[model samples]
Target chain A: MSFKDSYDIIVVGGGPAGCMAAYAAAKENVSVLLLEKDRDIGSPVRCAEAVGKDGLEKILEDNINPRWIAATIKKFQFVAPDGTVIFPQVPMTGYVLHRKLFDFDLGLLAANSGAKIVTKAYVNYLIFENDRISGVHVRINGVQHIIKSNIIIGADGVESRVGRWAGIDTTVHMKDMETCAQMTLANLPLDDDTCVFYFSQKRFPGGYGWVFPKGNKTANVGLGISGDRARSDSASARLESFVHDHFPDASILNKTVGGVPCANRLPKISSEGILLVGDAALQANPISGGGIATGMTAGKIAGNIAASAIKSDNISADFLKRYEKEWDTACGNAQKRYYRLKEGIRKLSDEQLNKTAHVLKDIPQKKQTLVKIFQTALIKQPGLLVDIMKTLNPFS
Target chain B: MILLHDNKCDFCGTCVGVCPENCIDLGEAELNIDHQICTMCYKCVWICPVEALFAEKVK
Candidate 1:
């Protein structure tokens, strides 16, 4: 009813990352409080909704509920600027989630795990005690209240202020930030459960576009462009025009806009009693701007570590650093590599994208894993070939 | 007014490629349609992975 004045762990932001952190921490029987700025559990959906099955399975077990999924992804298609398509063969892929439902469900799971959920509550600052994080200062309905907690987790999204409040340098450079816009349209004919990706400098310079089919002739269509190439153009306006031109007959459904943090993990993510997860930590997939799984994965580790540190009666920076190490080993390293690959690919021209598609199209559909496609792109640029060679080394 | 999130349309032409009336066109970040000739079937909305376009019932 009033502000939660105390808890074992306080997680800021009720997104995927925050939910996971609350769930995991509560699982350890810790008193956890999750604060969300939005009034509803899941409002203002900001995701493109396409996640690979294998990638998700790596983070979650098989028994996940089916209500969270909108559709199961079957095939993956890659397209060039001129529309040269390359069908990549892979095992079972992931799904396109109904984020509103999925996010709400995740919060409920955390609630069931004995975590407190507070909506429309904005965390204004970290409550510091003796130069260490002891709790959070939150504003709810114009009332400022301090919540004392042993640990604080920052999951407040791409341009997160929580990390900054915790004294973490969370600024994302323009080049590493992906500007995204999307819409849900109806009456558009598309293959059920197939996600299509497009690469072109004109449409999405230094990034790509995607169409994740959502059955019944509807889809979540969107594009991601790096901030460096965005200039002064309104990315949302651009997407509207594209839709009017391409699907003149498709009826409009809804629109959403947001930014995706394409940056790699921060140099440091732990400070005294604070831990960062999800987009707040720049844990999004570098190449695709997707973060559901990565955020969830890091959340699990961060929550566990926070509870353990509190139990051990130590909240020093050195003790909290284990959260970063565990998270980095689990998925941070792969994200860093993907970021490098994304940078390399960003340097390519539309013509290069077309040529790469041409070269890769020759590969049999059965052998079109992402690695092979990357290999094909590198073959055209000998210098890039060397970089690819270096990147290919597992140790690197 | 019905709108599209340009940043989200991947331009896979799923909307246009699949539009029976061929309403959707591909160019830059603009997912445009010939509004005068458009039908607003919303087939594109259902097919979009990024939810780039939406059909609004102008009451």
Candidate 2:
């Protein structure tokens, strides 16, 4: 698509969040432009590609395509440090997605909604007029172009520069970042419906290893360690050791590495005509580091708010503040509760984790649930007990 | 000084995200580190998943 001189809304990044923002804005009959720095919308997938089924269905509704799903997860297996296994029968189903196909479909949806889409377009910086975000200077196909927009949505991932360039404090503390590496292994024996998590401070200090089945005897095996605990070895090295020990005969197909911000959402996600979503806003789940569902939620809200503000001819920060308030009510508040639970869980020792697993193993399988497991594991953390109740409470 | 091994680098931009100085930039297929502002804190070196970045001493 040809670059326009100006657009009503410009979304920087072409991941799920950015595409949803563009799609939402364009559905409102606004001129929108979506820019992706990579050669394609979803090449070099960096995510674990897992999302809760209900969360995804809420956004896609009848539009959910079967081609985008790799595995329909039915259960979770938690392996404690001492090899004690605990089955947490989560009430809802999850899906291990084919992220490339899923993301490409979202981009297509945006295009079908009249949003212009461009790839290999790197946004260098933002343009300011009267100290308000007005446009962006981007390089496409090695050529520079200046494009103006009434509002800019920074859906860029963890390394988001758009937020930084806009003078928002997007800095993440070392401890809050999860350094991650994954390899798609084939010829592996695995259940097509179960996700496995390995918890060991010695093996994956401060984080955990995961084996998410992608169906067809293949799976994405990976591990993430907090940045503070990542000094001794690289994430790939640790993953290699884990893979070697567990899936020695499995052939490696693809290797990817990235960082996930497990911190709470940025204190300020909007300022003066600019809004940030997804990893740029640190919207991932603090405990699991999953952002697909929350990112899309925030993106949809931001896109709608941006379009309405433009219609009213008031794109000031005061008007954009509505985005933050709406996001807090939708997901940000729940995210805060999760962050607190994560803090409490982070302090559990290997022995404590093993003991918790043993305690849960004694319970009848029919009575096992996520809340019951958390209640048993965090019996001493009275403060987090309330946070867990608020976070997991169905009626709340 | 820090050196980047291009062959080993995956251009995943993990280094760019963790850099305290915010001097690294990940372009479409290239990664650049600005030595002028880098304090040699080596956060990127330690955090690189592929060990693409390393610290070097200049004579």
Candidate 3:
């Protein structure tokens, strides 16, 4: 009914990463506390709410929730700057999710694993002693509480204060950050199940605009521009103008605007008694800025590692180094490749992007696969071939 | 302390969500920062979409 004197692990932030961390740690019979600043588990969702099917399966395994799926899509369409529409039939398939339900369900799983789930708890400061983080000072329902913990998992997200408080360099450069805006629109004449992505330096600068179908008559329309490349308008303004120009008759149901860090992963993620997971550690895909899958994976690794470290009676970063190694083996290498590819693509001129679209368009549909698409995208950079090989054909 | 450049800000609330001090506040029509509570951490400055917030140097 009340707070405990101490916990084996404390996970700050109850997003997918936090929930997964709590669940994994609790499974090992460790006392884990999951704190969320928001009154509800999930509200005012900031994501565009889509995840690749293969990546999602790897993270969730057999624990897929049918209630959380809004749409399963296969068709892929890319729009270029000069109004060039290219349908590159690739092997990738994905699902647009109902994020609210998904986030709440993940937290429920964590609670079921015996982690103490506390909502409306805003962590104002880390309780540090002798250069080590031991716990946090959280305000729950206007009542301040000091909860002690041996290890802290920082899953707080892109603008995370947890990592910074623990003496990690959590600063993200402007070019590495994506200024994003999204609107859920209903009553639109969206006929296709295909997700459309519009790329134009003139419109979005370093990123692209996307429309993921939620159902027959509705879709989540959004865009993310490189923060440093943005000349004047905010992401929300650009998205509003884009929607007005493109989907004139569509009516908006909800809106959200925020930042998503698509930068390179930090060299160091764990410290004396703290582990930074998800966007806090910059695990989001550099190219797509989609992090749900990666965050979930990182949470599982960090949680399990924290539990093991507690049992070992050594809370040093040296003991938790396995978390970084495991993550690199899982998806870190691929993320690095994506970062390089993003940098390579950023230099491509608008005329060159249009040309690439035209070149891809002329290719036969039957011959167009994700491998070939990457080949086209990386024609200039031959070094990416190995990464593409590993990603497309992991076994070899 | 930190200063909020009103003209550059779009009031996206990204700064509000990340501020550990709860120094930054977003209203329906205005951006407010409580200077008393602000510790000059600069989390908001590094993450602001429009470069709205910045650290005020102490002389």
Give model 2's docking category.
medium
Per-residue error (Å), model 2, residue A187: 1.5
Residue A325 alpha-carbon offset, candidate 3, angstroms: 0.8
Which regions of candidate 3 deviate over 4 angstroms?
Answer: A393-396, B1-59
The digit string of per-residue lDDT tens for model 1 on A17-123 reads 89989999999998899998878887768888767666566666764678778778877888899989998765656788888988898899899999999997877
Q: Candidate 2 lDDT (Cα, whole model)?
A: 0.89
Which of candidates 1 and 3 reaches a greater TM-score?
Answer: 3
lDDT of 3 at A337: 76
Residue-level lDDT of model 2, residues A1-396, one tens digit each, is 577899999999999999999999999998999999999997879989999888888887757999999999988899999999898877778899999999999999999999999999999999988887889999999999999997999998888889889988787777889999999999998999999999888888888899999999999999999888888988999999999999999999989999999889999999888999999999999889899989998999999999998899998899999999998988888888888888888888888889999999999876777788889888888777788777763211
Against the true two-chain complex, what DockQ does each candidate achieve?
0.02, 0.75, 0.23
**Which runs in model 2 stand beyond 4 Å of their true positions?**
A393-396
Q: How displaced is residue A321 in candidate 3, in Å?
A: 1.3
- Candidate 1 displacement at residue A163 in angstroms: 0.9
| Model 3 agreement with the true structure over A41-154: per-residue lDDT tens digits | 876588988888888877888678889989988787778899888776657778899999999999999999899998878787899888788899988888889999979999
- Candidate 3 achieves a global lDDT of 0.82
Ranking by DockQ: 2, 3, 1
TM-score of each: 0.83, 0.97, 0.89
